[model samples]
Target: MPAVTVEDLTVLPRLARPGLGDQPRPVWQVTNAPSGYEGEGFPVRRAFAGIDLSHLDPFIMMDQMGEVNYAPGEPKGTPWHPHRGFETVTYIIDGTFDHQDSHGGGGTITNGDTQWMTAGAGILHIEAPPEWLVQKGGLFHGIQLWVNLPRDAKLEAPRYQDLRSGTVALATTYDAGALVRVIAGSVDGHQGPGSTHTPMALVHATVEPGARLELPWEVEYNALGYVLNGSGTVGADDRPVRTGQATLFGPGDYLTYAADPVQDGRAVTLDVIIVGGRPIREPIAWAGPFVMNTKDEVLTAYEDYQRGRFGHIPV
Candidate 1:
């Protein structure tokens, strides 16, 4: 397994880079972003939101919002917006967010809760800190990932899976130093409750210092790890990753992550999310909130929103 050191948190021992048939091990691909800002009205890094839909198939965009310690009166959030032809998965780590859509769906996703919305046909929604949170002001950290829909399911219908914190599936590693919350996929034999438009796994893992976690994944799926907190090494290339960085893994049957051992009394843990899915070979035409297969379809989505087809939130 690849390893990371506790001192400087750099990659330590890297195991053999294996071939596909060599019992499946993840090869470190690329490390990008010292981290930057993108549309959360806060600091965030754009994960898979790119033009190459075929490459990051079944997944479109991922935004990691603040693990920010917001000062007492300065919280930011987005207003009502329209989306079509895809799904948006929102995972909250800390703080509160009240979500509402025109389809008569609205709920709150507090810490560890998930809101998986399939904007199959089209829908308008609002996501912002709740009245209580906005009034009191505190830390707010979360992510919203866009999962692409195939051409057939593009306009099926809009749906929402507002999962509570306790209801989400949890799995423990054999040694018990780690806990994984399966949001949309299986991890360590436990499966998430969220449904999917694509075959994928979205898991948030927290591993204690000195623990080496090896996760098995389908060989045909594409996977990557995002370091949300602390530091660790990822994959057989044993790429060292600190907070706010994302590492894409090459083909492998299992991915390895190791948190640095404790130097002083305090130990460095690893908090990250692993996303993997079977590639959906399809064309993509995306414009802001609307993701479709053609430019004309994109235009139609905009026109529909402009024409008030997507319902509105009551004032």
Candidate 2:
């Protein structure tokens, strides 16, 4: 839960209150994420499950990796995999992960750090816990989001961005009741460090009990809010949402979410990840690991990958 925090939120730049002309985004739907295993059998919550692809345009899917405290020798991670036609954003909230790809893009990211990998054209990559972490397991929690690239940029060269926690932009509610960490894109003039082929914004916010967070958003981008922990109400109408839930919003100029006045001891505040992106609105042909614009393109990706066109895993 300690993705990033400020001892005194009041010291941070405050978000501007919604203007008179600002329109609040309406909550279109709320659905609970179903729990499952991923990678080498680590627990995960499929945050985008049951959500419509149209609403998630410009974005593919999201996985909430364990908020679990693993015992020694219980840690796990994903095996090598291939991806194309999109970007993978892995944000570590409370643990460490090692990332390496065949394209010479790799690093170790820990609490509050982010690894933005653009799998343009194609690439092979792997993610795993550090050896020490695997030996002496500790708390691990994070999010991995798949962002779709525009059709024109789908075959461009691959790129990677190692965005450190200190590089993230931070802000607070006007009343200093909530903390907002901008990981990518801009929020109320606070901009994140991660760059993307898509126009988007990614934010992690922690709202104190009874606190309300109102954020100005891009009118052109669609919006979604996923609760990482605790309970809250989304939208102006106060639609209830809780941990492991995702909220979809209709077109609007701003977004609103309020944490309940009471919370359990385990989670003293409500933690949420908010993301928005301009729609690509292109056809998507997805297979096990490849995401492409057509079935033929997907098949070609598989063929190219098998033929070692994506490059070899580092020795």
Candidate 3:
């Protein structure tokens, strides 16, 4: 939960209040994420399960990895794998992860760091806990989001971006009751450090008890909100939402979130991640690790990967 913090939020820039005639987004749907095990048995909540792909457009899926505290020798990670035709954005909130890819992109990202990998064309990669972390375990919590590239850019080139926590743009609500970390795209006039191939915005916000956060949003992008901790209400209509829940917002010029005045002992504030992107609207043929515009293209990716065209594991 400690991605980034500031003791004096009042010192940060404040987001402008919604102007007259600005339409507040209405709640379209609220879904409870189903928990399941992922890569080497780590727990995860599938954030986009049961949602239509049309609503998620340029974004494919998201996973909220463990808020679990692992004892020594209990932590686990993914095995080497290949991906094609998309990008993976992994943001670490409370732990460390090591990433290595065949394209020579590798790094260690700790709390509040991000690894953005574009598997444009195709690539082989692996993510795991550092050896030291595996021997002396600790808290691990993070998010992995899949962003789809346009059909034309899907095979351009592979690339990577390591965005440190310090680089994220920070802003607060007008009353300083919430802290907003802009990880990608622009929020109002505040821009995050992430360089995206698609038009999108990603934000992590912590709202104080009883505070309301109203954010202006892009009219062309579809908006979604996922709660990571505490209870809150989404939209101006106040539909109740809580941990492990995802909300889809309807058309509007702005979005609203309000934290309840009372929270359980374990949570002091409501933490949520909001994301939006312009719809690609192209046919998607997604198989294990490949997302393409057509089934034939996905088959080609499989064949290319099998032929070792995605590259080999580093010696």
Candidate 4:
């Protein structure tokens, strides 16, 4: 991965269409899925990494954790690790995700659960399947997105927001063709539970065939739409997209998306995530696991971790 700085993508351009009121927000660009690689123990397809994009401001990286069926004892998850200057947002769709962090934060998330952790100053954590799930062998799938923190507040006290399944804000369309779960920010007046340092919206949308959703978004925020399952179209332009794809949109206060239900009365379900946030637009000095504003700060962070400055994980 190459080192990406604010200079590299500050001027992100968008493809314009007839209008936001009628046209599907123009699909500026479609992402190319990179091959899957096992990180330490977790099998993942890195959807996007800040280091690979022209604009990686509020977000640094996103991973689609294994959606594969794991036989008993087949899944090896990430062990204890340290982080600083960023937040990790994990959403579980199937099976269970168990985690233990040095901060004494321990929990298990099942279907529809989301855990948001801000490793401000620093923290040590482990993420793996629950022992029972690992033994039983079943479906394991989830998403983990790295949300970046502003430089000035990089060293603030760490915090965690654990939202159990069905606890996060949710909205269903009038036609019942679409369902949206809010992880952060608001949708159709429904608000999420996570307290964020930046102004943003992270939502998971599932749309049945022929169903539609229009989100009132701010034109100033950088917006991204990622397809998780099935096929769907976005904006007034009706730009189509399939699974394993993401679309970056230009300035628009509203975004519309729908699934193309074309089967024999069986709705072709479309699952996608839409996220928008104000870009920090500052220099990014990124090192493995640690993201700071400068190289000197990154080096200092490594030194602090080596010296046990962030505190210790209970054995």
Spell out the clash pairs found in candidate 4.
23-236, 23-237, 24-235, 24-236, 24-237, 25-235, 25-236
Local distance difference test scores for all models: 0.75, 0.92, 0.94, 0.75
Provide TM-scores for the models.
0.87, 0.98, 0.99, 0.87
Predicted structure 2: clash tally: 0
* Candidate 2 lDDT by residue in tens digits, 146-169: 998888999989998999999999
Per-residue accuracy of model 4 over 1-315 as CA lDDT, tens digit each: 000112222132221222435433455777855647555566676776423444656888788886678898887678678999999999887778788887778898878888999999998888888888878898877788888899878999888888876567766655555666777886546778877888888888777777776766666677788777777677778887777677777776677787886623222478787887888888888898898999999999999999998878887
Cα RMSD, each candidate: 6.1, 0.9, 0.8, 8.6
> After superposition, which runs of candidate 4 have C-alpha atoms over 4 Å from their true positions?
1-24, 49-54, 263-268
Best by lDDT: 3
- Could you tell me which 10 consecutive residues in candidate 3 have the lowest summed lDDT? 263-272
Model 2 CA deviation exceeding 4 Å by range = none
> Alpha carbon lDDT of residue 84, candidate 1?
95
Error of 2 at 54 (Å): 0.8
State the lDDT of candidate 1 residue by residue for 139-240, as single tens digits: 888888889998999997898888877766666555555666677776545678888877899888777788877777767888877777777777765667
Scored against the true structure, residue 211 in model 4 reaches a CA lDDT of 72
